[model samples]
Target: MTEVQTLEAPSARRPSASKAPRTTKSTANLGEGFAARVLSVLSEHQRIALRLRHGEGLSPEQVAARMKLPQGVTDRLLADAERTLQAARRAFVEALVENAASRD
Candidate 1:
């Protein structure tokens, strides 16, 4: 007699599909206004970067060392933060446009 090996599907380890779909949709919506909110929320990091680059007059490499982040990673994070802020601003503008269009 041979014993059969049972394999679990990947889906079994994940959340229920029914909930995941809705969560994904909400995440997309959150991403729409996420940048601006993130900027407002993480103002301290921005301040640190500003201080390092302007106030202390440190280069990105120096800033990365001081911040204890990898130089390339720090650069990417800063750029992403800026882009996220821009995305949030764009989302806000788009919302205002939709609201105005609805009024008309």
Candidate 2:
């Protein structure tokens, strides 16, 4: 009888726990932090506009009626608030990226 040859597979190695990347906080935490910072920078009118339109889920016309302001005025306030929020979001993202890059 011919001799049989067998080969054994090598054992897999587990990644070291200390070498794994660590996560600081969840996205929800980051979002809440960003929101708090944005709120700190927003004007009273802008905060009120955001609360009425987003928190209360009111239509632009409804917001205008509730505030007793003209549709045009409400529209302007909403637009300005939206712009402020966009700028803040961009700044926040840029700062986060910069921080991560610095860490790396």
Candidate 3:
């Protein structure tokens, strides 16, 4: 007879302290700075979408109803805002890297 083995799911297992993710002061600061920059550069529609979804903790359907826009349009607006923020973050990080390189 052949021996049978079973494997546990990853989520069912507990991670060791050393394997846990760490959030340092610098990492937190970087996240805050990135968010601030993204907000500053967002278009009016993007700003509204972010504010409704995050600031007020509203669902996308609720945001659409509040904005009096179609659900599809609201979804597009949210997606666009996310894309814009990601692009801004990339640019901000690149600028920081370039500045550091220049100083070296």
Winner on TM-score (1 vs 2): 2
Greater-lDDT candidate between 1 and 2: 2
Alpha carbon lDDT of each predicted model: 0.62, 0.75, 0.75
lDDT of 1 by residue, 1-62 (tens): 11113578867775677744343465567655554355466557665764576567788888
- 9-104 per-residue lDDT for model 2 (tens digits): 678565688965455677558867777877777777777877898888899999899988999988898888778777877887797778777978
> Could you give me the TM-score of model 2 versus the true structure?
0.67
| TM-scores for every candidate against the unseen true structure | 0.43, 0.67, 0.60
Question: Taking the tens digit of each residue's C-alpha lDDT, what string does model 3 give over 1-104?
Answer: 11113579867976798975466787679867777766777777778877888778889999999999999999998898877766776787687668657966
TM-score quality measure for candidate 1: 0.43
Candidate 2 stretches with Cα past 4 Å from truth are: 1-23, 26-34
* Candidate 3 C-alpha error for residue 31, in Å: 10
Clash pairs (backbone) in predicted model 3: none
Looking at model 1, residue 94 earns an lDDT score of 91
